[model samples]
Target chain A: MRSSYDVIIVGAGPGGSITAKTCAQAGLEVLLIEKRQEIGDPVRCAEGVGKEGLIHHIEPDSRWIAAELKGSMIFAPDGTEIKMSEEASSQKAGFNLERKIFDRVLAQQAAMAGADVMVKTRATGLLRSNGSISGIKVMYMGEVTEIKASIVIGADGVESKVGRWGGIDTSLKPVDINTCTQFLVSNIDAGEYNKFYIGEKYAPGGYLWLFPKGEHTANLGLGILGSKCGTVRPISLLHKFMETYMPQGKIIEMVVGGVPVSGPIKQTVANGLILVGDAARQSDPLTGGGIINAMDAGKIAGEVCIKAKEKGDYSVKILKEYEDRWRATIGKELSKSLMIKNLLIKVSDEQLNQLAHSLSGIDTSKMALPKVLPILFKKNPKILWELRTLFI
Target chain B: MSVIVNRYKCGYCGACVGVCPAGALELVETWIEVDNTCTSCGVCAKICPVGALVVIK
Candidate 1:
């Protein structure tokens, strides 16, 4: 790789690769780095991305699509199922993805756009000159090397060290992080729609999800509040959940990771550096899904970086524009979703059953997840009184 | 760098120390701790099995 580049992005996941691709396409030299030996190995996510989110970045590739989902079934603790239509589940589109293939395709797009792709390269430290970031020091196959850049994008996930190294406070609270574990199970009977089970018995402070990948394979997972379930491993809980709900299925793959249930970080940009994707806490507070938001941020940041390079100014003041644009577009929805997450955590199993029963008969033809708030208030006027505090 | 393990949330799984590349993390008396000369990479905070370790900003 050259001694320096116009931009260097840490982490070659969907966010970093997309950012690199966009910047390179704009004629800025870009360098993309990944710590893993492979671009998308040891998958950390549930491998499910909504159809609407994927379309915003690029056209859907057939090779990346695992299955097309129609809708979602919400199950109460009492087993009362509320099936929302596909149109209702996604205000736009939906799908289960083959994440490994999808992530690799994104990196390949970046490479094709003229960005230097470096794998097995771990960013060990940030290069600072007089309190300003100039580049990053990386260990490539056990050899330490430094690559300078005009701008650095921290696309690293939930445990992002790049942000911290750049002086951005990206810490998550215990109650705000979801301990997630999943299994890719085969031979499971599931529908075209995804399934979500809610209850303390199944997953406390979170829910269990089943996103069917094919006729016999599905991504089965659950995320629970880390503070509530002590001494119970998330993997063990997932196994118990499968035993209770999908006993006959065979496990094809097991994965564990954390999902930031909090909204975006207070600050996402600093002098010569920007944070994207999970590093910026861009995942949905309710769903713990971030592929779309990450891609959106990547596109915006890429555009901003190009502008900054033209002006020869990589100051925080210039980078702040990206933050303003992203927040103006998706920040409101993320904040609203976080409010819903906090409220959902306070709800008891009995209350969930009651709410599920009350909404079981409602017309979900044009419903959104937030639309259920009004119905929740109608069933229990007390919730309306309590939720008033949230609205204000 | 201080690894603050919320006593209430930590499950003591030792996954944080396991994933640490700098060898700066260790379990002390059932609680995870970070030693001096730490890099503050946030790997422990990221890999903490229970979301217990919050790297103090």
Candidate 2:
């Protein structure tokens, strides 16, 4: 890499790659780096993305679209299922992707847009000049080099150190993060609909998910709240779950990760620095889905960054535009999701069973969270009274 | 007491780094490094999805 660039983006995930593509296409000098030699090997996510949010940035390709889900089924601990309506779940209607290929394609798009792509280049610390964040200190092939930049974007996933080096707290408590483990299993009856299981018996503070990846194979995973984890880790819990649920299935691969369910951090920008994707905790607090939010934030950051370059100003004032724009869009929903997640954790398994029973009579074709939550709140007011704040 | 990491099993997902209250864990792309700041509280061990970490006295 050269001694300097207009923008240096850390991490080559959806967020970083999109930002790089946008900025490079806008004629800015951009360098995007990935710590790994490969962009997306050993996938850390469940690889699901909503079609609408995804198509907003890039067209779908069969090479990476593993499965198209019709809807999702939520199973309470008692085995009562709540099937989301086609239209309602259509909001979530999307594809299970092969992230190994998907992430590479995104980075390739960035390169095509004229951004420099470097792999196996890890950012070890931030470069500060005269009390202003200027660039990054990176280690490549065991040689550390300082690359200067007017702006740095931390798109570096959940174990993000870039944010910390730039003085953004970015720390997560045990209760705020989910320790997740997933397995790719074959020889099972995988369906078009994704399945979710909830309650302590399944995941305690989190939930279990089965996302089919076509051809009788599926990604089965569960996340447990870090605080709730005991002698049994998520991997062990997942194995036990598999024994009871998909005994016929044979495990093929394993992936482990942590999702920040803490919503967005208080601040995502420091002078001359910005954070995106999981680095900024942009993932959904309820669903742990961040690809869309990350891309959305990256788009906004790109715009703000372009404006900053044009004005010849790279200060917090210019970067705060990104913070405001993302907060106006993704932030509001994330806040609501956080409240919901907290409520879900507080509600007992018995209450969840009751909720499943109370909603059983509703027509599945018309069932949506907006409609179902109100009915649930009305029926279980004693337990769900806190939900009033969300609707109100 | 300190934390031990099973390098072979670590996916380097950084789940342990995020939950380390002492900020003792660092993800080095290929592996996780536990620093002296670790109190051996075993929080990272508990949260390691692959069970790759342990608190050893």
Candidate 3:
């Protein structure tokens, strides 16, 4: 690998790949490195994203789309199933991806866009020059090497070290982080609907999910509030869930990771560096969804980084524009999601059942959080005083 | 050489299972099991998010 480049993107996940593709297409020397020997093996994501937002950025590829979703069902502890059909699924109509293949295709796209991609190459630490971030020190094939860049994009993920190394405050409180576990099971009837289960029993301070991949196959997963998981572990809870629901199913794959679900961090950029995807805590606080958001952040960072490159100045001033642009896209929604998530956790199971039962008939597909209260308050206007912020 | 997981401390996020180069580690509902195929390269222990997996060389 060359010892230097115009841009160095750490992590070849969707976010990093998108940034690399955009930047390389703009005619910059880009190097994208991944720690894994393979680009997308040992996938950690559940791989559900909105078609509207994602299709707006990239074309659909059948090789990676595991299942085309038509709708979603949210199950409350009391067995109330709130269905949002495709016609009404404004924000949820999308696809369940074979992330192992999906993530690979993205990195391949980056390579096709003229970015040099490397696997099994780990960024050991950040490289510095003149007291500012420049590139990264990488280890590959048992050798340590320094690579310089005009800008570095860290899409490293939930426990992102890039931000901390580059002086950005990326620390997430336990309450903001969701510890997740996923299992790919076969020989089960998953149907086409993506399902989400809420209640402390299924997921303490979090939720459980089933993203169907194909006929009789599904990705079963759950995320628990990091702070709330004291003696309770995700596996124990998931085991019980499976025993109760899919006792005959067989697990084919398993993964574990954390999703930053509170909101964007205080800052995602610093001199000569930018953070995107989970690194910036860009995942939705309500659903812990981030595939599309990461791609959006990547596109913005790619464009802004190109501008910074041409100007020959990679200061925080220029990099801050990336943050501003990112925030403009999904900042408010994420903040609101965080608020809703916090409030939901405080809600009793009875309230969730009531809320689910109330909206189970709504014709709305997207079912935006703000619209929930008007219907909810109509049924029980007495508690509206305390939970008024949810409507706002 | 092999990998071991302390079930009590293990959050069972499957980080070790995901990183195991040999595909010898699997997280069953009860615990993380290290099978006969394990080469014990220690990648699992290194990548354990909760520091539950330990490698005894």
Candidate 4:
């Protein structure tokens, strides 16, 4: 890496790559770095993204699109299955991605857009000048060096250190995190729809998901809340679930990780520094999805950086625009989802079965969640009252 | 040792590093390092999805 550039973005994930691409397209000198030797290896994500949100960034390509889903099925602990058709599902239609390829494609796009991309480059610390952020200290190829930049963007994933080093409070409480594990299983009949199983018996304070990758193969995973994890590990819970539900399936690969269900942090900007993606806690609290959210935040960050460049200012005041813009859009959804997630965890398994039963009668093909929400509210007025923000 | 990491099972996803309240854990590329700041709260051990981190008194 050179000694100086207009911007330095840490992590070449979807968020960082998008930010780099956007900034470079605007003629800003950009440097995007990934600590991994390969830009998208060691994938940790389940790789499901909404079709609508994805098309906004790049067109879906067969090389990376693993499966196109048309609907979803929610299985309550009591074996009550509630089906949702394309229209009923929130994202209408969705795609399960091959993140290994998709992330690299995004980084390649950023590189093609003129951003200098490097792998095996890790940021060690933030370089501060007179109590103000200036740039970053990176270790590239076993050599430590200081690279100066007008603005530094932290697009790092959940293990993000940039935000913390920059003095931003990005801490997550035990209750705010979901400890998760997944397996790539072959010889499974997952069909074409996404499947979800919920209840304390299956995955306490969380749920299990089966996202089909292709014919007879699927990504089966579960995420349990940290506070609810007493003695049973997430992987153990998944094993029990598999033994009972998918005994014939063979596990070929295992992935373990955590998702921030804490919603967005209070401040994502410091003097000459900004945080985006998982670093800013932008992942969805309800579903623990971050891919689309990260891309959205990255887009906004790049746009704000451009405006800041025009004014020759990279101070906290100018950088706050990125936070404000994302808060107005993605942040609003995260807040509501957090409230709903908090309430959902408190619900009993019996109540969930009741919920599924209540919705089983509707013409699911034409029904949207909003259409059935009123009927549900009538049955459970207490939850409806708590979720008032969603209505008004 | 306050915390012991089973690198064999660790996926290096940084889940433990993210939930370390004391900020004592760091993901150094493919492995994780526990620093002196660890409070032995067992939070990292409990939150490690694969049971890779063990906190022993």
Q: Model 1, A93-194: lDDT tens per residue?
A: 478888889899999999999999998787877998756798999888679999999899999877677887888776665676777777889987867878
Instruction: Give per-residue CA lDDT, model 2, range A205-308, as digits (tens).
Output: 89999999998999999998887886767888899999987899999999999999998689999888999999999999888999999999999988888999
Tens-digit lDDT track of model 4 for A93-169 = 78999999999999999999999988899998989886678889998889999998888999888888898888886
What do the candidate models score in CA lDDT, each in turn?
0.79, 0.88, 0.79, 0.87
Against the true structure, what is each candidate's TM-score?
0.87, 0.96, 0.86, 0.96
Number of the top DockQ candidate: 4
lDDT of 2 at A169: 86
Ranking by DockQ: 4, 2, 1, 3
For candidate 2, what is the DockQ-based docking class?
medium
lDDT of 2: 0.88
* Candidates ranked by lDDT: 2, 4, 3, 1
Candidate 2 residues lying further than 4 Å off, grouped into runs, are A85-92, A366-368
Question: Which should have the higher TM-score, number 1 or number 3?
Answer: 1
Comparing 1 and 4 on lDDT, the stronger one = 4
Residue A310, candidate 3: alpha-carbon lDDT = 90
